[model samples]
Target: MSQQIPFVDYLVLGENPHLVANECAACGARFFDRRNACAACGATGFRKAQVATAGEVRAFTIVTVAAPGVPVPFVAATIDCEGTSVKANLVKVTPDPEHVKLGMKVRLATHSLGTDSAGTEAIGFGFEPLETAIDGQ
Candidate 1:
């Protein structure tokens, strides 16, 4: 069996790959990373919270340049998953303003970044346009 590893620490991979966030128990504020204390309430209590896979694009930008070999014109967006905002790349469609729009519905999608000669695969996650975009509403 090929071994798999997450691209980031908060990403959980398996049959249902999902992202986890640190949710402040006191104020219910969520953060993508571990926090020393709640930014809203200054509470030290927190819990591992599973974020919803579906979200709406709040903002986005078209990238025309990136590191070597990386594709250009990709849509980098800030998505609101439930209540938490997540920054991720938008995939599965043309990366343009006409196609990728603000408030577009999207779903979490995962892909294999690449594999090593040792048969280990690196997993990556992104958001893709969902059925809600079909009518272009």
Candidate 2:
């Protein structure tokens, strides 16, 4: 059997998938990328912190145009995951104004992007509506 890998380094792919961030030890600011110093407080220390899987949609936009080969009419959103702002695509729902709204509750979800020649699948993460997640959809 081939192994599955996360598309991003912070995504932990397993029975329970979640994201981790580098948190500033002094200021408590979380960042997904490596940082030598805290941007908010100029702290030089950091620690691994688990990000909340559940979040609220703080803002979103319906993208109708994109680069060639990329799909259009997708929801690009900013989610507030326990006070941390996460920029990710919203999936498993129609990309329309009526369906997606600000302050909508969402939960992290993973999907298989594709497999490589070595048969390793790359998993990507997204946020789905809370209702859909609760219903096991």
TM-score for each prediction? 0.91, 0.97
Question: Of the candidates shown, which would achieve the greatest lDDT relative to the real structure?
Answer: 2
Q: How much is the lDDT of residue 61 in candidate 2?
A: 95
The 10-residue segment with the lowest total lDDT in model 1: 128-137
Listed per candidate, the RMSD to the true structure in angstroms reads 2.8, 0.7
Candidate topping TM-score: 2
Kindly give the number of clashing pairs for every candidate. Answer: 0, 0
Q: Rate the local accuracy (lDDT) of all candidates.
A: 0.90, 0.95
Clash pairs detected, candidate 1: none
- Superposed Cα RMSD, model 1: 2.8
Q: After superposition, how far is residue 128 of candidate 1 from its true place, in Å?
A: 0.5
lDDT string, candidate 1, 34-115, tens digits: 7999988999999999999999999999999999999787988999999989999987868877888888999998889999
Poorly placed runs, candidate 2 (over 4 Å) = none
